[model samples]
Target: MKKKKMISVLLTAVMAAGVLSACSTGQSSTQNGDNAPNTSAGGVTTIEFWAAPNPTQQAFWQTMAKDYEAVNSKVKVNVSAMKESPTSEAGIQAAIAAKSAPTMSENINRGFAAQLSDSKALVPLDTLDGFQDIVKSRSMTNTIEPWRFADSHQYVLPIYSNAMLFGWRLDTLKELGYSEPPKTYSEILELTKKLKAKYGDKKFLWAKADLADPTAWKRWFDFYMLYDAASNGNKFIEGDKFTGVDKAGLDVLTFVDSLRKENGLLARQVTDPFENGVGTFVDVGPWTFTTWAEKYPELKYNVNYTLTMPPVPDDVDPADSKTFADTKGLVIYASATKEQQAAAVDFIKWVYSDAKNDAAWFEQTMLPPARDDLTSNEAFTSILDQHPELKPYAENVPNAIPPMDNAKYNDLQTIIGEQAFNKVVKGGITPDAGWANMKKAIESALK
Candidate 1:
């Protein structure tokens, strides 16, 4: 991690005024600032930004805003903390409907961004100056493709990303006479069976399942991880239409069902497998490593843990093993004034253009950088070196698939979870029946 620098005189003055105001009022509105517009003094354009509620993220936005204000005195940034939840979408939508939306927002996922774009509420990033070049220089085409709508308009600027990866307890593997982790789904199945036989009463694998309320949503996380690997980057939707389940999807469902039945993998909810040493094998994101290090410092540099990209089915190409990349970025509102939009773009560009700021962001968030260049940055690489468990994330980024930009994703997920997943996993229905019901549900939802 890099050392913090002293704040500029101008920023210090502004922060001092805010501190005094809070002291006199016994509280500060800056803490929430949601939907509340700030008045810009001295004819400066105030760009309202609703930021995610993460403390580090909020601090990052405020620091960037003050830095931008110091350089460009004509623009002032008013950042508000937005909670990351379904309610956030409603709040943003309400603001947009009232024509009082913020100039930009953080933590806008592809699904919500697409919804906003469909309603003509987003300013396409491609229409902004220097944005395309940043995409070409910093991000890969595959990473950006998921955010492009049917009209070829990109509505979000991705900043950070995370992907699912396979994790195994190395000490457990060695005790079981294995030198390496499974390479494919078939291998995992075979390994799980052996482990089950050896430890009949204990759980051998931490597979995804929801026996109590088995729904398509319960299986979605694992399904997409394998689906991306099987389909090799094909999205579930194309041109505002649902491309219903294919052979790849069925294969994944079958695999998941089989794991629960034969592998002694618990279908019930449990605590964090990696943290509590609950399972020999688990699938997780980058944050798992950070959490483990922070809670169990004794295991910080222990080589008893191994992390690798999720394995594909035996029939699928090994090189095609992929996982879903959860991308969060900034999005500008169509309701924003032209000047405010320009300022929003400038602020994002300034933050990403400098490697130091980008590196600091990764260090603070523990999320992988969206930019390709940042992978080679010493600041970023140094952190990876210290926490070797996070190395798999950077290695898997090249094959990571972004989520589909479908507004109906949430609805489709509920249908699949209830109609398809729960039925197949616990309702004594055949996989084919579940698949057919899922297809019908998706079709109905799309209409």
Candidate 2:
């Protein structure tokens, strides 16, 4: 998909709900009897669930619901597929406002989850019995830590997690007389210079730089990835302060500016550098590997890789590199009755608690499982054996940092990408000037 399409889709789903109301006081009569939790004549408690619109995902949930119903005959799952759009969350929020929210939501954006948590609209997963131990046994602490907010409450049960990494064509790098990809920003510049010298300036390293489009706010991935490395994993919000626009932020912007002006490494538009063979190296996620395996098998064989963790300055320790982490999972709405909430938790626990089921999810979705122990599961290990390059990405799980959880996350991303990154690269503004504009934009949005 185009960066515009992808960003627009992802953030549109996340922020479409607007601000959730803090007052969950008066119940709305607009909630139809069928929409609310209902007990059948046979005494089965029927609770509704909203599943992602993807056919495979919907099928998976339906199958799970059937299996769960067979096991717990007293609970009936009413699964409904969501509309496929960035504004899917708006529909869910509308249901919630009408006091008809689903007992459980199958897919939730991290930022939106944070908003729900802040508004007290989500049930605390930590309160569930043995939930802590299950999380510890199934997933890495770093991977799970992102869901735990300052209140020490985990609002969502993460199903899978992902991070950004550097992908390259080993053949191209070897032809350039380098055995390995660049490990640092300085090394990247040096390699870019060599590539330009060999193939002309038009054939520079291609990195996405489409900041003007709303959907392309993901362009800020470059900035956050680099800043994480330079800052040694310090978060933008430490306690209650905005620590993003700091020295590390300046360093990242300056480096990006240099990449654009000095090394000719940055692409000013959204282009597939790898498939087109325009870029010898690019930053991407594990999903790209799955895409290559399916559509471009030849390119998949030729590609070498590096996780973009520890993006440190030339003078800093390479071990300190960190990368942005994205986790997707389910959250229960607080509107669910005690019986409905317990049933929802039971379904989640049953699904993830089993090693085989977790591994099966990985096999089907090609997404890494949330639980740590499943890494050794036969199904998951077989996938790694088929594509060993994925091992490095799996190793990056420990270094993965969740995206900023602020309610204004989407707006902040747009500000950074448009006001700061776009200006420095395309408008000829200094990094300092760009940062000042970005800071103002973020502060205004946060308020």
Which candidate number maximizes TM-score? 2
TM-score of candidate 2 relative to the true fold: 0.87
* Candidate 2 backbone collisions, by pair: 8-215, 138-371, 138-372, 139-372, 229-311, 309-321, 310-321, 310-322, 311-321
Q: Which runs in model 1 stand beyond 4 Å of their true positions?
A: 1-43, 83-86, 137-142, 207-220, 297-302
Across 1-447, the per-residue lDDT of candidate 2 in tens digits comes to 113244322224333343244215423222335443444437767677888766666777787888888888988888888754446666666566556667787777666676666656788888976576667656556677756766668777777666566676677678789877777778877877788888774566655545334333465356677777778777765323467737887887787787777656655564666656766666776667667667766775434533345346787788767776655778887867666777777777676666677666666666666655444556567777776766666666666666666655666677777788767766467889888888877776766
* Candidate lDDT values, in order: 0.67, 0.66
Every model's Cα RMSD, please? 9.3, 3.6
Off by over 4 Å in 2: 1-23, 26-43, 209-216, 238-240, 293-295, 302-310, 373-379
Collision count for each candidate, in order? 4, 9
TM-score: model 1 vs. ground truth: 0.84
